[model samples]
Target: MGGNGKFSRWKISFHRAPSAAKKEPPQEFLCPISNSLMFDPAIVSSGQTFERACVDICRDLKFAPTLSDGSKPDFSTVIPNLALKKAILGWCSKTGSGHPSPPDNSEIESTIRSLSGSGGTLESPKIRVSEKELLKGVTETPPILLSHAATELNSRDLNLSSSSEESVIANSTPLLPFATRPSCFSYSSSPSTSSEFVAEEGSRNTASINSSSEDENFITKMRSLDVYEQEQAVIQLRKKTRTSEEARAALCSERLLLALKQLLNSRYTALQTNAAAAMVNLSLEKGNKVKIVRAGMVPPLIDILKSGYEESREHAAGAIFSLALEDDNKTAIGVLGALPPLLHELRSGTRRSRHDSALALYHLTLVQSNRAKVIRLGAAAALLGLLKDRDLAARVVLTVCNLAACDEGRAALLDVNAVDCLVGLLRNRAEFSSESTRENCVAALHSLSDRSLRFKGLARDTGAAEVLMDVVKADSERAREKARRILEGLRGPETAEDGEVDWEAVMKGGVTQARHRVGKSSNRNSTEF
Candidate 1:
């Protein structure tokens, strides 16, 4: 709400009006997401503009960031940003900003291919291992993944015994003694062990492929008809992907995600919950987050939120909360109709559901459209209802602060007697452990008071004036500043309704009185002389 000596609602203005007088092109000519002058600016469903290709890639990947107001751009429909595009073209002609040509379709495709790993994304790195470990890996106390990795050295036709293995030394000569590379051959020097070395060398490529094959088989099992097999598959998936970043990355491809998405809608309670839990585990790997959503996991997850089993709903919410943390997944989740159900869970679901749903809402609401949607659905009243218990107060209040940013949110909050609710929390601040609750209480009140005439009376009625003054004197600087802003608004009315002066009447009366005094004085002066 910071403004230039005037009241302004919170808006994310990434661009400014172009003035031909200025030498530089106005910031609005560029796309915020791409940080480049827009050549083909296009508006998506939320009425925000970006480079057209940016939108396409985002949709194809099912990735978008949450905008500031808690809503995300919906790429389902697009309109050419004709006006802005025209202005940008005009400016480019005048200023000659020397902007480079925007990327072409082929370049964009290449980027998509690279990001999705479709275009030469795989690279088989030479596995690094010590000589001792390479020998130890085959005997198998604990399997060494690096040892099992394909060096493909046999394809090079290098008949390396122990001397040649030592000679290669990791593609560099100096680090030979300490570092060794893994491949199809064993690190044996004796001519007698040549067969053993060759056999070991040959197994590396097969082992690596089999390892990859084993992970793919998980998807097939997950989609199996037998319930027990599906259950076991989910269990093994959940257990394996839980701690292994490698496993999550390898297992969370398109087919596996589709299979998991199917299980998310499973009528069986245990399978649904386990699948959801495994999703949460998989999403823990940063690389898998966007890919999971790209595979269309969101719609099924929403199904779980709506009518899944009690235990499953929490996992569903947990998965959503996890995915929402990713910048790209935020929009897809919100756009796919997760917002209202999440708010529903926040209000009436399990303790865990309530917790995760609250968090999901916090991220999803960053876009303006989503904020309005939640407020319209009565989120303000629902959130205020949770404040009755101080135990839930601190956690839920962060989201309350977010809701207070918009006009609808503030109005909705005020309608729900939020001023009174927040003031009461401030009065008993010592009872709560989190200063943030008290801080947020003051902030929500500050936002309410920002441009509201009704807030003055509400604060005066709640004795918010005195409580805020105390905070300004004693609370943290941040809380105190917001308290000061609210207090400033509460100082007094700007003008009195019934206290206007009758200036015209006063002037006429004054002239008549002066003339009467002059006539009386003239008569008296003649006699006195």
Candidate 2:
């Protein structure tokens, strides 16, 4: 990862090659880059997997290859596909095929050169006029090379962190379901529901013409010189995009993204706040999340969060939270130094800022890298300090639960004697607080109990063992299950070994179970067998 703020800066060198196999390998096992068995598979940020060496070769040549699925792979960052590599090797062994070796970097480069020479060039998707018509399939190649997207974005002079991959055909499952958008955006009771009203007139107005004309009209207005015009355009765009899923998708053109990126720097407070608010609406649509980040909005948004006007800063935090919903954007967001400000927001920002920051932290903390980044930010202490504020405690507790999922987070939490804070929360079970807050507290403690050797002692010292027993009978089934496990862990292994089973009774129990379950009513069932 590079500090130049360009998103596509991950660098990994790979060199290996094997002979062509006699048998055809699975399509997915073959790197999209090499079109051969991949000795080393790596995932990129935009949810595409490729060979490690092949990605390097593309980076070396400053190429962004379009896939068979018609979408461009965001080669901003890459991670070793340990699971996929293991699966590929196992498949090779099962079929008695030789293991795939990495092709020499020179050989891969030569192949790319030949392909590009034979008309494999691509237009930048960012500036494409018919942005909506860019077919976004998951695989395939255009017979053309694309100017590396990162190069074009670097002209922004502003920069941030790198990127990575997501899914292949076989690795299509997400770790967690994106069941809801950032609820803090509208202060809605339901996670996915919006309190904002849909723009019914826009729907009726766009009934005759497609969204292209409407989108262009808005993009044109958004980039206008007049602050009054720009402000009006942003307000309209924000309002239209708020609850219109169609507007959100159709208006997410690269031109519009770039326009919004510029407006985020507006000197006028109203327009800047509107830009941030529009960003939140746009990001609610799943397709726009990664696009918004790639459009270079992150750097300016981070700037706003760090020192913008109070109202706009609130929207800025909300925008960042919304963008982080996509798993691909999580790493880049954290690597760009979002953690410290977010932690600061949790400690001092307005109520909404704290809530959105917590939500963003919750999603960002899901990955190990971000967890470690945030832990290094002294997040454990900051989050624990927020527990006293009941309004923010629910999300704060949930975010802590995410942190507890990783070993580093667990260590950090334990360092702060979080055992006492969490146990007290569980024991008190504030009458005004939501059950989920206490449930998440239990969940965090449970996660800590799993790996920390000192956790049992901490739990017993805080009277966590007794508190957990009470939670075991509480309303939340999940909380109860976790509480039961924590209680069992606190009991120690010695208790289980002390109790011995009666062999004679066990043997009788098995024979008695077989008598009723083994056969239907029959006098000679055993004789028949």
Candidate 3:
């Protein structure tokens, strides 16, 4: 009786131990479905565990989980395997590695679903993940399930027998889990919770994900394509990015801007134009301007202005115009020898390119260092030529006026016959120009004729006397005041007091017929010059 009882106890203990050990997961912790390490293992109704995302995908597909023993188990009922999840958390914390949070069963089930045939084949026509969904930060494609689907399709196409198909599926393994994927790839699991955690932690990090995903996808597409395809991709990227300010800001990374700089060098016209357009948009952010300039963008932009298509020239000039908004870029552009090409565009490019080039030079010349370079580069002739067109008169005149502030620029303008052009425009102000033009023209004359009797005489020869008298009657107080000063300087004390001519008497004499000429060597303050 004692031996019989002992034997029964021993037999019961032996049977229970093997059964429990069998139910325990392998020491390596492989997902039952994907046959990969279960980063976040979860249990389902069949009393088996798989990676959270992997098995949830399986359940969504109504696919049975293939067990370790080469048998299929029902996975209809899903539950988080808390014990396994805790283990994974512990391991990651202990190793100081970041583990991706698990996928939310409810959210995952709604956003994405796999379509598998009765024979377990995946169909074509993949559903695209929307940007809004991506921003929520929890959505990802189920690569493991997709891998299984692909294996199933391949098996079906080969006309494998049921047993052979099972063998193939069993041996197939998906790539690494999301947590283990290369740093370049990102997926959001358990989005609502992760987002809340991220928000509580600070949502600023989420903005990086937006840029990262876009940058990664763009780089991948760009690297895989030929030049023509890259051009098309660049055009599409520009189109998509232009519509979103956040996208523009997000794309303002050093790596991507360098790619754009390289694109600017492409011989393909479309690529050159599109790359210029993209740089224009990206440079809208002040921070990106410095990055773009440092990436050696100016020289290529100058190249584009020199030889690119008309639209490319316009965009490239416009990009430089935008970049020149940064003071640092202004100096850099001038140093990179951009003035010659820019001046060429101002003289001969399309109207848009001409205006854009002028705009760029306008900003670049704002730096004192660049002012001398622009004047040295012969901007005076080009600008004076454009000034004749009434539509471009104000901008051209304003830029010339600014340039004329420096001695070298004033001397350059006088040498290029800018005085005659400016005086002609001033004389025809009411017919072809605005009050601002009158003021700037007066300022240009002031800068040019202040110390040089030759420029003053040149102005007088071009009917400066009549133009100044008419300007004195102008409604703009600044214009009226400026015109009077020039008229006084042009009128000699032969009319009255030391330097004060009678303006009332001068007006009575009729400005067109008036000859108000100050002494050639008048004693006006040279310091004012």
Candidate 4:
């Protein structure tokens, strides 16, 4: 039995026959990858058993196999062979050499017997189990055994039953009660009334009953739908998901997100709209945001933004806005060329799409490199076009401020006549406009004022001087002070030596004025624009 392998000691040795008296290890128990008796075995899609570690190694190579038929199976299709794993565990327990301790198998055996006839043959249920029937069938056995039995019985269903050819079909006669069905079993909390005998097994049984009920409901809904009806069903499901946080979280599953990504390419406008809407809600979570972007959702989202229905474009822009929340996603989206489509949305989409697109650009331009990319994509001109939209004015102003943080951005804005737009916003000071929007507009103009005497001359040329004078009398102290400083800076001498209005002193005075407005004398640091 002492072969030259790591698992050599675990092999079962046997003599061929009485006459031959030659020893050979059992082939069925050996793992193909390691060529030794398996300690932890699993099955691949090819129906071959290998040590779990070997399967993982194959997965790392993308499951590329040097096979005789040149067929390569996807690594994702590999599944754990629970029956073989348990058999090995039991064999080790029986030998008392491979296993140090083993769980109780007697309860597992009893649970199996409860589902079988006196002769050990399973009995098919006459009717599907209902909620009341499942609650009545709660067992005292460990859930771990039931989970393994489900896997084992499933394998037996393929091998022993003649009616079905699929390996995963449950046997015609379920080995366990439908209440304890593996497809939907879960662990739940015990009832508050049973404080004395609140066993873990009872809690698990209760959870399994509830889970089976939910599974049945979902199946019934799915079974009743045709192809077109299914699309509508998904739309309704998306609406329901928006109202429940837990449902939104559940939509974050990789399979579901991938499905949504595929649905982005659907010919049906309603399907695409609902899929994008669902993804917008799903991407609210940080992890799901990363997953949605990584699933190649950004490009299709941009496409939807380009030419989808009115509501679809809004949802697509909303999804892009959510994905832009992460710093890494901001770069990923930009690298995927999201800027152009976002700018396109700003220029021509509905008012809501323009607002959401501005928000997406706001986050993306937070990265300094993306600022130049956005300006290059003609964002400066597009933002200038949206400046008049009162509904989108504040976000459009904020995005301009972010882009105008640098000289190149300022130059681009000046080239696109953004100075005229900013001054126009300042001129009216609409009663509906927010204080933040006015502040952002002034901040962008101030950054533009930093470039050169020529650009400052450009501000004055764009009637910025008269607008600043008007803004100087506004109610907000910060707005008044920023306007006065720009007014003085543009009007004062061009050289730095000209007692040129000390910027720090001016900012300190502005903060002082702000504190004075609220009647606070305590000194505080001046906030950066």
TM-score per prediction, in order, is 0.54, 0.56, 0.55, 0.51
Candidate 4 local lDDT, 345-437, one digit each (tens): 877875556656777888799888789898777767878877787656766777788877888898898888888888888777654345556
Candidate 3, residues 1-529: lDDT per residue as tens digits? 9999999999999867744632333454665444444655644433456665655344334455345577575443333454666776676565555664444433443333432334434342222223354334322322211111001111111111111112112211222112211011111222333223222322222333367878866665555548756765565456444324456667777777766777878776556656776676566555677888898788888888888866667677777777776777878888898888888887787655666676677778888898888777666887888888865665577689878888888888888888898888877755554555567778888777666767756765676766777777753566677777666655533433554565664555532223333322344422211
Tens digits of per-residue lDDT for model 2 on 1-529?
3565444333221111133335677777988877888876876545456876676556545577777868677655454566778999999997779987645555776777665664435332222111122212101212121111001111110111111011111111122111011010112121211112212222222232267887788888877778877876776676566434667778899888888889888777666766777776677677888998888888888888888766667777777777787799999998888888888877888665766787788878888898888888787887888887766676687788888888888889999999998998877764424555676788889888885668866765776655766676554677888876765455444332334322232134332222232333333232110
Please state the error at residue 482 of candidate 1 in Å: 1.1
Candidate 3 residue spans exceeding 4 A from truth: 1-209, 492-501, 507-529
The whole-model C-alpha lDDT of candidate 2 against the native structure comes to: 0.62
For model 1, what is the error of residue 463's alpha carbon versus the real structure, in angstroms, after optimal superposition? 1.0
Residue 165 of model 2, lDDT score: 14
Off by over 4 Å in 4: 1-226, 430-433, 491-529
- Please report how far candidate 3 places residue 506 from its true position, in Å: 3.6
- How much does candidate 1 score in TM-score? 0.54
Better of 3 and 4 by lDDT: 3
Measured on C-alpha atoms, candidate 3 has an lDDT of 0.58
lDDT score of residue 479 within candidate 4:
73
| Best candidate (score: TM-score) | 2
Report lDDT per candidate: 0.61, 0.62, 0.58, 0.54
- Stretches off by above 4 angstroms in model 2 are 1-209, 431-433, 498-529
